[model samples]
Target: MSEKEAETPGKRTRPGPRKVTPKYLENAALFYLQRFATSAANLRRVLMRKVERSARFHGTDPAEGAQWVDALIARFVASQLLDDALYAESRAQSLRRRGASGRTIALSLRQKGVEGEIIDTAMAAADEAEEKPELAAAARLARKRRLGPWRAAEGRREARERDLAALARAGFSYDVALAVIDAEGPADLEGEGSL
Candidate 1:
């Protein structure tokens, strides 16, 4: 197209790049950010979706969508709206309170994208604050399942093996389960039991 045609109103043949409106982006970011503390990755995904959807509806470019996510995250960090370390700690503590083992808590946090070191550190902190429950906790769990503290002089070796196996499957250490089994005797609802 000639310069004269380009300058003429409605004569241009090409569409220029569109500018992403700052106000629209700001509103989109605030909309989701208000829901709760969110991770950078999750925020990005949500923003990307919203941008794409809006762009389609309004004849806007999808690339403009990325700007809002970065803007939102920077604001969140500056305002202390998002902190992975704090998130990890809170999640770790919550899991522990529900009777989850240290290993379980660590793995769950890791699955949520927490770094291994952070998970380990949080778990260590939790351990100090909440010492491991005595073998009794494990025993109580075993007993609840009717696995038992095996009788000292009661059933066949096979019955004893079954009790030992059950305890091990419950995630209790061999030592904890055995000690409890020895003290309480294996369950034998039908009189056939183990020590």
Candidate 2:
């Protein structure tokens, strides 16, 4: 082996990330927004992480990066490119469709840095969009996990308590869990037009 190649370790050291600038932060934010719906705070968090990484590797000032992030976020919000209310509502609906209870959806939105008021509004919207939203969500969960009515006849009776527990753990109330778990069949859940 050549002395230059042999002198190096088996693994090559990758270059550090580029120093964060306003333009770089803007580009990163735009790219992120293009792929995922996010609240202003969540987007800020993502961009700040990039800033922090660059600061650690390139000795850049995080405070400067933070200022850039703040300005970029403000600009996006002003342009209506970042709408927390819309994000929360859309996310709540999507989560509900995937069997997430209202409580679960609220918690998820909170973790994403959405305000409580906005989460409440979003949840109300979700509720208005469906009758007995919790029950519907529970039903969807049961169907997806093959619990309760979706289970085979032979084992359903034996797994009754387990099915209820699963729904309970998924942020469903006891009443909702029982209703879904004790359902006679998938058709029973659809009686309320919730399915």
Tens digits of per-residue lDDT, candidate 2, 61-171, equal: 999999999999999999999999999999999999889988899999999999999999999997787768899889988999999999999999999999999999999
TM-score to native of every candidate shown: 0.51, 0.93
Compose the digit string of candidate 1's lDDT tens values, residues 36-125: 554555566666776776676677767655765677667876787766677777776665554445556666676656678777777776
User: What is residue 156's positional error in candidate 1, in angstroms?
Assistant: 15
Model 1 ranges off by over 4 Å: 1-38, 42-62, 133-195
Candidate 2 lowest-lDDT run of ten? 186-195
Candidate 1 differs from the real structure by a C-alpha RMSD in angstroms, to one decimal, of 12.8
Which residue pairs of candidate 1 clash?
Answer: 149-181, 149-184, 149-185, 149-186, 150-181, 150-185, 150-186, 151-185, 151-186, 155-193
Predicted structure 2: lDDT = 0.92
Q: Which stretches of candidate 2 lie over 4 Å from their true place?
A: 1-10
